[model samples]
Target: MLKRCGRRYIVGAIRTYAKDIRFGPEARGLLLKGVDIMANAVSATLGPRGRNVLIEQLMISPRITKDGITVANNVQLEDRRCNMGAQLLRQTTSNTNNEVGDGTTTATILAKGMASQGLEVIRQGQVNVHALREGMLEASRVVCEELQSMSQIVETIGEVEAVATIALNGDKRLSDMIGDAILKLGEGGVFLLKESKCLNDELKVQEGVTLPEGFVSPLFANQGNGNRVEYSNVLLLATLANIERLDEILPALELAKSKEQPLLIIANDISADVVKALVMNQLRNCLRVCAVKAPSHGSEQRDQMQDLALAMGANLLENATGLSAIEAEDLGVVSEVIVDSSSTHLLHPRIHNEDQVHARVQHIRALMEEAITDEEVDKLNERMGRLFGYLATIYVGGANELEVSEKKDRLNDALHAVHGAISDGIVPGGGTAYLRCIPALESLAPSETPEHQIGRDIVRNSLRLPCYTIARNAGVNPDEVIRQVLEGSGNFGYDAAAGQFCDLKERGIVDPTGALRSAMSEAAGIASLLATTEVLITEERIRPKVPRNQVTKDLAGLIGM
Candidate 1:
């Protein structure tokens, strides 16, 4: 009987070992599923026309916008399995965005494709664990090569337009306008260009623009003690000196009244008598006032002051003797006085012809407006919907040019937008560009080789965690979700190929937390793979050996029982 029992025990142990080994396949499948899901999600937003799907799901309170980073950052996933994958994906996306100003979607797609293809080789029982690693390295090399081949040098404004059009998916008008704006701005000046129909209007120049010495109220009327006032159609003129006081108000008021124009008082300070006289004249309602402090003598201070003046109101003036003097000279009735310390001499306001720069600016503004339109934006969405594509630019310039820095910054911002779009859209990359490379990794997969198989199993198991999480959050059966994702028959929430989401429907309707979940899963997978073999072995061996006996153990010890 004892012999029989020993045989049974041995059989049971063998069965348990078999069960453990079987788990390897399941784990591997899960990892592949996660890689596919995330890859597809990122690839959905590759081109310039890529659409941001998550923005649509946002509540009415938080305005929705089709931006990938926002969507990816916002996704929420219920399952812990996908957390690492999602996190790694997001990190990769973010890194790509920060580095190139574009191509985040492509990078994400590449990563997922690489991981999936690597796993396939292991599954095929061809390659060993090292072979899979080698394959991934080669895959990365290919992706980089492809990216380099696609990247074009943008040397002229025309080249910029071409690139923009490509990124924007052939929006000619939109591309033209953006190009025009860059060309019009050139390198040296700031121009206030109006935006029309999403396009920028012609640059409006403020001649002899002056800056205040220090920050002060936007409403100050001519060195006066007058009460605070408001007005419509008030012209603002900025100056550097403190001149006319209460004595200047009446004369200035008389001249202003003669023109039957509403009055605005602007100065550093005013005399009390002037304030009373202006009130008695019933000119208070006709007036709006702003007082700006003078700026220090320096280019930086001047620039800061000029920006402030522009923010207040248009029509900036330099130096003026006093309100009384301005009135006597009939100097435009002091529509609005702005004080600044940077001006060397007084300036007379002059009218600008919008027609001069109007065509150029207006054209650009129109393009931007058109690009953002429903139809145009949709086209962009379509182009971006493709998998495993990249729009990249390498900006090469001398390190010292401020213009280069500025251009680089703008480019980076645009690139960041592309990344954000991809994260939100959640599409796959290039139909698994690493497909051809799988055979190399298959040679690394082991059949009876336990150690090799263990590595493959670890990677496979890690990938599945994301799939489980995605399934749970989407409220789908985890097993069914896993199978469908792996088979490429269904999507988690958004369509990678369409760059649209049935769940979101509108722009800015994605769950950023879901993206985070995917990223976290990827991270965990990496951590597991990189951890020391000894650590993994310890984790596998450690087991619960004791049962609850808290009360009895303490009591028995106290009684020396």
Candidate 2:
């Protein structure tokens, strides 16, 4: 029996702990085993013909789906060590999703295969882990270049629609809608998800939707006036909602009236006095400015408002800057605004692109390349996202909640797939993109050089896993697909649906190279990290709180207690 005293481990008549408790080989073996177990668990859910995994829950009904990322996420392990290994492997998959927004399955399979092969080679005692990583790094670089070279442009609407169709399992309706939305928005569009209130069971695409920052007080509620209100030619303000400044907005309100346009006062705040003044103006037929607090607050709120100013060609009222902040040119044109007690909706039907938006994108990219830190890079990415200028919302309509839920998932997948294609072009999907990378890596096989040989073996095997798993999952023999694909010259491979050789591109099966690049980078990163992991350390589970009287006093002999 083992006992612990004050964070120390004791085996016999000792009250101490060993510092270097290394289960080096065992730990590594478990890493490989754990990752392999997870990969195999999801590998069966890889292709079009891949079967659904029935994940049963305690008391609840089981879930059935062929989504690889979903399967990986729901993976469970009874053993503690295996669970830890699975968790570490999961980081790669998670990163793939967050970064590239697709290819979680391929990433998982690659990471596990790399870990397994490298572990086996090192276990033979002929080579070190560094050699494996060096080869993998080179192999990964070549693979990336090959993928980029193989990519076909997503220029036409139909081609882009192919990407979404394949990702959505040939749902042409959703795919077409997504494709058209991307084309209409011109690549800088964000996705806004919402439920539909229409009679028909369908998905509707709205050009743009503004996120309301916060709601106004109930006193300003248009109660019984329905929830939607339309405002035009709004005076957009960025100052705090101060009642004392009620008179400050009079000039802009009057200017809009003279121009024969409705006044839309988008302010940071609407003090009680200002609200009353606007209401009185409406009653007296002077001018009715639909007052709404700007959608967001603080630094983020300010930035968003500023972006709106840029998009709408409106001027932001900066009281801190000067009194001149409320110029006539600063007023913006908003298509409509839906005001309510809970929130406000600002809609811009037309997506007007400023020439500076394109310039800003290029500038942001250059700054990103020169960034010195992770923080800087992230900030630049955020800025780039803002420059996109608009977010397109897909209002999904369903007869019930479950149908809506299912449609939302499919729509999301289609959107991400379409987004990735637009961002980085695309490569042949159904595992062919990953499959094609093997020959490039195979060239590095060093027969006589054991150190390099270990690395080569790890990469070559790992490089094939995605294709292999995909084929195997589709009920086709992996060995046959590998031979056929290797025999062909161009980008052609086994058709998962027919279980025969065909052009994947012709079949409308392809994946985003951006997503592929992200998946590969993450896969390589996780494999390299696992290769260098010398030990797995876990703290012992703490016991329940001890009673003070029952506790072993440290100064027992001195105090005779």
Candidate 3:
């Protein structure tokens, strides 16, 4: 029987074939080559002295950036096998960026060093590759512990500036702006970056709560005013119920219309018919109303809705039954609400339970302290921001669009780095923290197996690559710099930008401990995976046809041309 498959046909086709495959050293070598290329490109943007990379865009002007993840993301190899290897390294940087926000370059450089060394050890046939990979991971864990132990809390704005400065590659003005925002907001504050219309950077702050949710339909927005909706003295119905039927909240809509007030419904969902009914009432001027899908999902949705309802002085409706029984006393009120396609903002309004809101904020802060994963911590921070905190935005300005884009990227990096420093504390910068942990890694399992020992050695040596690269980029001898750093104690390291040796903190050079640790752990993880890779499989590359004349002699004669 013939069957349709995608855009092609199949006649009892069940078999599959490998397009390309390589085994042993050949596969590993090509992958390593790709890793080398990507790492080399990114490492050039590693430290205070790091150089900017110019990236060509599809239609717009090229981008000039010193961001490591940006450079790593733009690299593509011509060799398929090599590209596969580069992709693996790219994942390492991507993971670091997502988790820590500012360690992609450090992660890439470390992964490259470890993978290259592990491959060399494998080629010698002296140790078990699996055992070596295990040792590398174990060493990585120990180094992470050491880094945590060495971290210093960022108590003052100066410390915050230091972390931001390193992330921004010594842009002190931008770093100071981030520091000021953090200072003004205190802990758990939320601020964002935006492009400025003016050529001078600016900062704006307001009393409001922001949610990553908006109107259910554009029809709900003010007509012909883009996808934006605004209401004054609004009534809010917060619920987890999925509103498929209009009658579920018709009583509340009537109450809103009678009171001559705009109504906003925040719920898990709103079906098409329900949205249509709401939009019709709004269009006919019978009622000013809008429905918004609740922020987040699952338990998070429940928690956020509850918090939002509390802040808006309303009680949360849990199900369709609760929605159907909605009363004036059950709904909440806010001074004003402004919503767009992407987000909703509740301006300074009413607080039904001020003490409870304070209690919830404390609870979230406590949860943040115990949150094990970055995802958990981030969610908790968002909750804190929505519950009760300052909201600020930094408007980045530049001479041109490309310049603004580049500065925005740098500001984003600085912002993340500062937040990381606040949460996880700061460490000696310029890779000093990684090097300081080498002693702990070396001392681990003094009587381990040969393969394990080799694995540990590979990771131990790879940890120094970040500092080495930083010095090399600064036009200094990296080996000498590493030697001097090892000879000194605690937070003592090279200042690549100044080409001097001193305590990193004294030089106002420090890294967010969390980002630095993420860099180490993620790099080691990817390197171990590459170390044990004995087989590589990838799709065959298809080349485009070469251009040629379309008309042959026979065709031309037939056409009488």
CA lDDT, every prediction? 0.39, 0.67, 0.84
- TM agreement with the true structure for every prediction: 0.38, 0.78, 0.74
Better of 1 and 3 by TM-score: 3
Over 4 Å off in model 1, which ranges?
1-28, 48-58, 61-71, 124-152, 187-561
Q: What order do candidates take by lDDT, descending?
A: 3, 2, 1
Model 2 Cα displacement at 272 (Å)? 3.9
Top candidate, metric TM-score: 2
Best by lDDT: 3
Error of 2 at 75 (Å): 3.1
For residues 1-561, what per-residue lDDT tens digits would candidate 2 score against the true structure? 234463353342242232323477888876677787888887776766766676755445555656667678877675556677787788888788766667777888888878777776667775667766777766777788888988878878887888888767666787877766777777765565667886343434443334444334333334356444545444443444343466677667667777777666666666777777777776576764566677655875676666656665565666634333456666666676556655555566234357755775677668756676646654555455455645455778876654565566566666777878987899988777877777777665455656656665666677677778778877768888877887875658777777778887877778899888887878887887788777876543333333366344444433333
lDDT of 3 by residue, 540-560 (tens): 665434335565654654533
Query: Model 1 over residues 1-561: C-alpha lDDT tens digits?
Result: 999999999986765554222134455555445545655554444443344343333223332323344445544343333444466556666654444334444445445644554455556664455644433333333333332332222345554454444344344564455555456544222222122232222323233333323223322333335323334444443344353455545555565566666554444444455555555455345533333344444553443334333333333334454443553232322223334322221133333333523443344335434463334432332222110011111322423333233333333334333333333322222121122222333445354554344544343343344334333334446565444445442112332334433322122122122232233233333433322111111012223334359887666555434
Candidate 1 yields a Cα-based lDDT of 0.39
Cα RMSD to the true fold for all candidates: 19.0, 7.7, 8.2
- Which residue pairs in candidate 2 have backbone atoms (N, alpha carbon, C) closer than 3 angstroms, thus clashing? 213-295, 241-269, 315-330, 429-510
